[model samples]
Target chain A: MENTTSNQTAQNDLQVLRTSSLTGALERELEHLILTGELKPGERLNEIQLSSRFGTSRGPLREATRSLQAKGLVDAIRNRGVFVRSISPKEALEIYDIRAALFGLAGRLLTDMVTDAMLARLNEFLDEMDEIAQQRDFDRYYPVNLQFHDFLIRSTNSSMLAQEYKSLVNRLHLCRARGLVQAGGLAVSNHEHREMVDALASGNRERAQEAFFRHVERSKQRFTTTLEK
Target chain B: MENTTSNQTAQNDLQVLRTSSLTGALERELEHLILTGELKPGERLNEIQLSSRFGTSRGPLREATRSLQAKGLVDAIRNRGVFVRSISPKEALEIYDIRAALFGLAGRLLTDMVTDAMLARLNEFLDEMDEIAQQRDFDRYYPVNLQFHDFLIRSTNSSMLAQEYKSLVNRLHLCRARGLVQAGGLAVSNHEHREMVDALASGNRERAQEAFFRHVERSKQRFTTTLEK
Candidate 1:
């Protein structure tokens, strides 16, 4: 009887771990959905529908909604339900301002911590970006550009900074579907990326900071210009 | 029958709004608990227990947990339950680095956006801080110091920056319990606050930025010294 109870306890622990991992996976999926604009802003999330769609039970679905709510991606109403958060123009500008500060810090830290190996990896990524830019492959280039920024942020080796940066970038991604359609911005973006990488390679902290700021400012300009039309 | 059906719909909508507001309040409470260290790191947050403590039901309690998880305050495992997040010395340092960058931005923006009324209000707050410092009332001065930084950030009128700043401050509060202990740092802190406010009042961006950086460095020094001992 003692042996059986011990085995049962071990089995129960494994089951708990599995469920937690499953919940985490579900949360990530929902995060992607919101960040990628699969679920548009202000769209209501029906738990029952989502559970059926994901082939899960309501338990995980509810948990995922809670996760998203914490991330500022969704708003939970008392009895009603959760809905995707809508970003206003004012909110967008505010987000960009904070992003600029974060990227500025990342650039400075990146310069301070640069290694030849890291530069080479950055160059490899930039070359891929160059090819995509030449082909005007906005779809493919967008994700690559994001990866480059992510790489630099992670390279800084500051997890807190990276975590906050990730949230800002995710929010920006949600707004990208509406903003990245600007004319002639793609080439400028690629050029900015090149300049930024050069600044990092040279270990010029001031220039690196400027380059990153300029890149974000240019994106903001593009966004505003699109909104104007 | 139609009247009854419409009434039911109205009731459901009301319930949703109520749930959202309740969840919001719950999030704030949980955040306070985590930041104030009332909830110890790695402590289990059982839903049933939390619900009873907060006088809420399981639904809102779970929702609050999700929000905290997103903020990196708590980790929820499947059948096991949620636990408060734990940080090490390395993580604490990383968080301080991020705070430096963020508060640096706030400083620059505060200089650029300073208004006459804001300066007056800041001066008023500074006088109060001076009085508290003279009295060696760290308890009163502690919150005033936070408000000085908070006021500066809010005056920038950048909600997103304020939100990110609040998060970093919350994390710092959790890590070291800064300003909670009765130390002789209040005098230096008051002097720094005066310098920061004066720099802002003068609309000298570079000076303000330097002062802000110095202020943050001083705080970090205090925290590190305390942690070392």
Candidate 2:
């Protein structure tokens, strides 16, 4: 009897551990779906459907949904269930402004601390982007561009800034701005990247920050131009 | 018989509604306690103790904690339970940098859109802060200073940015750098604010943003000086 009770206690503890990790993982996965538009805005989060789809039960899924709601990526309605939040163009531009802020800080901090090796890595990215732009292959260029941005984001001294930067980038996916990156825009964008790299190479924090901020400003302008067309 | 069964279902739904709302409220209340440092960093979150203290049950307390854990404000270790996160000086400075970035963006956006009435309100704040600075009164200066900052934070076009700016301010409470504000520091701080407002009044986006960013940079420097002392 004593052994059975002890084993049952151990099982319960294991179950608790399993459930918590599952809840966290499920939360992230659901957020990815929502942000990437796999789950469209206004789509109801049906517990029964999601549970079978994710191969989980309602308990952890509900917890995940609550976390998503807390993050402002979803809205929970009484009896109606949760739905992904939609982004307006104005809000999208606002997100871009915030990204510009972080990216500018990243460049400033990077200028103060960037090593020769880091500079070489950035130069290599610029070279790759130049070739990709020549080909007018935006599809091929997109991931490399993301890599370059992520590299700069990580170059910051703070992990919190890096995490927040990535989160903002994820939020931008909801902006419906992907198809707006045209071949001509890619070349112009690459030129701005070249100017940003040159400023970083100069090791002037003010110049580097301005170059970075202006690049984002130009990108935002390009986005607005596309929206108008 | 049909009426009785339907009544039972209605009661069950009401119970579900009550429990979920209770959980959401508990999550926010617990986050408040954690962020405000009432629950000190590294202190374990005792489910039983918290539930009894909150006059609720263990189920809601545990769910609230999981949400907090997801937010990086708290941590859950298997069997040992949840503990609040401890922040370092470097991380605090990084948070400051991020805030500076946001503040600068707020200034840039505000410059493009601020009305005369908005400018008047900011000037009024400057006057209030000036009197407080003359007395070299740190306590009196703090709230007005916060009002000044909060005013700028809300001036942005994005509600999301405003929400994020406030969240970052709350996280700074973990730094334990409050008593470091001196009477002399108050006067010096208002001088920077003076320059920032003057630049804002110029209505040049670049100038306003630079002034705002530099003010935070000086504030960060002041924080470092206090830390060293």
Chain B alone, TM-score of each model?
0.82, 0.85
Which window of 10 residues has the lowest lDDT sum in candidate 1 chain B?
B173-182
Instruction: Name the lDDT value of residue A173 in candidate 2.
Output: 70
Q: Write the per-residue lDDT of candidate 1 for residues A103-131, one digit (tens) a residue.
A: 87788778888999998998899889889
Worst 10 residues of 2 chain A by lDDT: A175-184
Q: Per-prediction interface RMSD?
A: 2.3, 3.6
Candidate 2 residue-wise lDDT, B1-229, digit = tens: 9999999998985786665676777888888888767899889989999999988888767767776765667777756788887667788888889999888888888888888898889889988888988887778888899889988888775787897787776677766664454445777788888887778778888888888998888888877888887
User: Residues B122-191, candidate 1, lDDT per residue (tens digit)?
Assistant: 8899899889889988778878777888888888888888888887766665553444433758888878
* TM-score of each prediction: 0.83, 0.87
Quote the positional error of residue B145 for candidate 2 in Å: 0.9
Docking band of candidate 2:
acceptable
Relative to the unseen true structure, what is the C-alpha lDDT of residue A219 in candidate 2, on a scale of 0 to 100? 79
